[model samples]
Target: MKHPAFFKQFLITICLTFFLAPNLEAQTKRIKRPKSSVGISSVDNYVRNSFDLYDKVYKYDGYAAAGTPLDDDDIDVLEDALDDLALISESAPDILSSLDGQNAFKKAKATLQINKANKALKYSVKTAKELLAGEREREKDDDDSSESNENSDEESDKNINNDNSNDDGEEEPSNVSDGLEVYSKYDFVPGDKILFFDDFSQDFVGDLPSKWNTNGSGAIVKLNKVEGNWFELKAGYRLYVIPDINELPEDYTIEFDVLTSGLSNQTSSGARLHIVLSDTNAFSNGKTHYAAVTLPLGQYAAFNINAYNHFNGKGGMINSGLTADIRDEVKNQPHIAISVTKKRYRLWVNEVKYVDIPRFIEELDVLNYLKFHLYGLKDGEERVFIKNIKVAEGGVDLRRKLLREGKISTNGILFDSGSANIQPQSLGIVRQISQVLMQDESIKLNIIGHTDSDGSDEANLKLSKDRAAAVKEALVNIYNISADRLTTDGKGETQPVGDNGTTDGKALNRRVEFVKTQR
Candidate 1:
């Protein structure tokens, strides 16, 4: 069939464009397996292929009419694939480090470079810049392999599991902040009521975090080669807001787990994270009244109030001295706990005390808002990820609360899920109460157990009873408290202190209480 002259010309042009478009053709084609480099580790080869695929999708092709413009849907699909590759590249180094070979150094260098290449393909100009810059700074960070830390997955997991069992064969106490045995050095206690809690489990991958409000952008992401989900900050000067800090109790605790993305060779730079409390609902662009705790790379975590800076000023030095030294291994995540009671503030990182302030809040002021900030970021400064954030109230004067309130309730005494056996992590609080009981030998008490409104009522009641009894047994056998001095009871779900529907609320309702008995 004969076609119009212009139509014929258009058809010929289209054919030439498709034939000459090398980059666009590569993007549309199935990923090609690159020839294996001599002596390249399997992990390194995989990383190289992934980065190569990313380059084909994002790099420009020479032909002017070589590619069709991607629609929003197309962009989204490509971006998702890019994200997967980026995460895999991020964790490839750690996996490579786990291997034993002379090629380890070569693999590590290749792995680091591939990660940089992945970052270079990032879609946004700003985000791409921040991520790429972070990679650049991490060059020195890649020097120390995870092996140098002497912490292998086998060893770290073993430690996490046996945190309760000690070599001495004696039951050591647990940490007050988190339900882990080795954290016995921690003296933190959660508040009586849980104000806010989030694990990021409810959020979908590659979506905004469900439990937070941020002025900038962030996403709930799980590293392709790592365990757990994290809220990754995607921009600078971003504020991560917890919407529930309406009227915080004077005595409360905040806890979360965090890791920096730029953990390379035992050195970290350009990553700064801070927690702030202010009177405003949203953090403003300009100055406002606020108190904050800042953690800078390679230094002690500092606390700042208004104009007084803990690490830089004399007034700041009075309350600052928590050597965080967040280096050695980037993936070795740390748990942070901050407890506040009236004017006093104490913070714990992992099992060690980072700061202790007897009088941080000087007046009748209450921190009505809570926010997290990331700043001082340079071109390769690492990105920070946080998860399992919880804020609880009531840490000061436990004995006073028990006596004055007639009952002292605690979430510290934890048990295995659906089991009556008390976790070894609960020993810390039990020991504390035992010492108090010993100091006042004449005092008689009743231990009561409660559960959230879940499962069958009968089952919950029985679980609660068994848990109460377990607590009593621990006090009697482990602490040598007289059985005659303590009585046990269970309320099950009938006496709930928090909403049954929410995770934090359910955690709150499942607790043990000590009631003073009139002997």
Candidate 2:
């Protein structure tokens, strides 16, 4: 207590020291030096720096600036510049800032130059594509001109033939007009439920189809002149296999579109397509027994069936007698339809019945794998394209379907190729319906006709109506069914059950339906 002011000063100093000492220690601990020796900058700043570099490197900005003309040789130069720019941009983050911003500026310039080079490359590629497309189109035009010239010659030949008409001066019937006559009495229909269908719309060009495999090289290729992807079979005797999708029912149908090109002419003497069905999952396995239908293509085409059937607990090869050659229907694209009813197999090319095997397979369950084999290939002289492969389960009881659902839709009743005249074989299906009607006297039916989207709407509608009336007439005249109990109507190519772009869909669309008016 000698001096009060001294004591107060000493107290203040002690308090200040207590607070300041801890704060200074904490501040020193909180400050951290970056692990790397190089100074770091924000990502925003880094990007901005790169932008500045890009502006400096490329004198011009943007891709579309009119640059110097480029040829194929310039592709390499532009590609190299692109690569260097990419490397510089990748390495820019690691550069030390102590040196002048030369490296950063260079990187920014590269970025801009890279962008410009990309634009130039794209333009060059586009130009190349356009030139190639033009060349193809010109080639197609030349081919078309040649075809037109050949047609003119054919017309001249026809005119000569017309002069030498019948004894009564009637002009000779042209093959084009008489083509549909071959399809008369052609009654081929698909099965009931579709099991598998593929148009190859999902497939990638220049690659093998994911859904199909072949022992020989086959690729999904687009015809420059044609629409859609086609399964291009490379060479002879190769099995283009659609591996087992589902077990075959007792009654099933298989339909596909086949385009046989590379033929010398429409009547060229080389064309054979063998469609085989095997019992095993894999066709290549030794244990598999197969039944095949061989169809020769072009004019004068004949068909035969060969089956290795398991008879008496053992297998033996059975071949059917060759059929009479129907003028080869495979000119451009032909729809091939085959119906399998237990042991029997019937095949139709377009609308003409090609083969009817009463006993093709011994058992229905013995069939699983389906494949197409190209035969009669003369040293890579021919090419085959197949699309729209559809398989469906068969055996629909018409009476049952009508009774259960109040309506029965059928593809079984077929007509002449482009006419309303019902095929003679279609009477069998009508007979079944008549029997049902006879057993149930109170049943009344509305017979409806449908057509595929292959023709004009007005024509299709007229054809459908005529066909429905024809069915009614057949039921009344041939089957002795009551005219009063039945009514007829037509819906032409309007309501479709399947894709119109496909052959199977067209087949399904072309059908006769029976709707129950009263039961």
Of the candidates shown, which would achieve the greatest TM-score relative to the real structure?
1
Over the stretch 314-340, how does candidate 1's per-residue lDDT look in tens digits?
Answer: 233333545445442124466677887
Segments in model 1 whose C-alpha atoms lie over 4 Å from true places: 1-185, 221-230, 259-262, 284-286, 296-321, 324-333, 375-384, 412-428, 456-459, 473-484, 487-489, 517-519
What is the TM-score (0 to 1) of candidate 1? 0.55
TM-score of every model versus the real structure: 0.55, 0.48
Stretches off by above 4 angstroms in model 2 are 1-184, 222-228, 264-271, 283-286, 298-317, 396-406, 410-444, 447-513
Residue pairs clashing, model 2: 53-108, 53-109, 54-108, 54-109, 57-109, 298-328, 299-328
Model 2, 380-497: lDDT tens per residue? 5567888768787874556676667878787767665566756444554677677778888899999999998887999889889989998898778766888999999999988888
- In candidate 2 the C-alpha lDDT for residue 363 amounts to 60
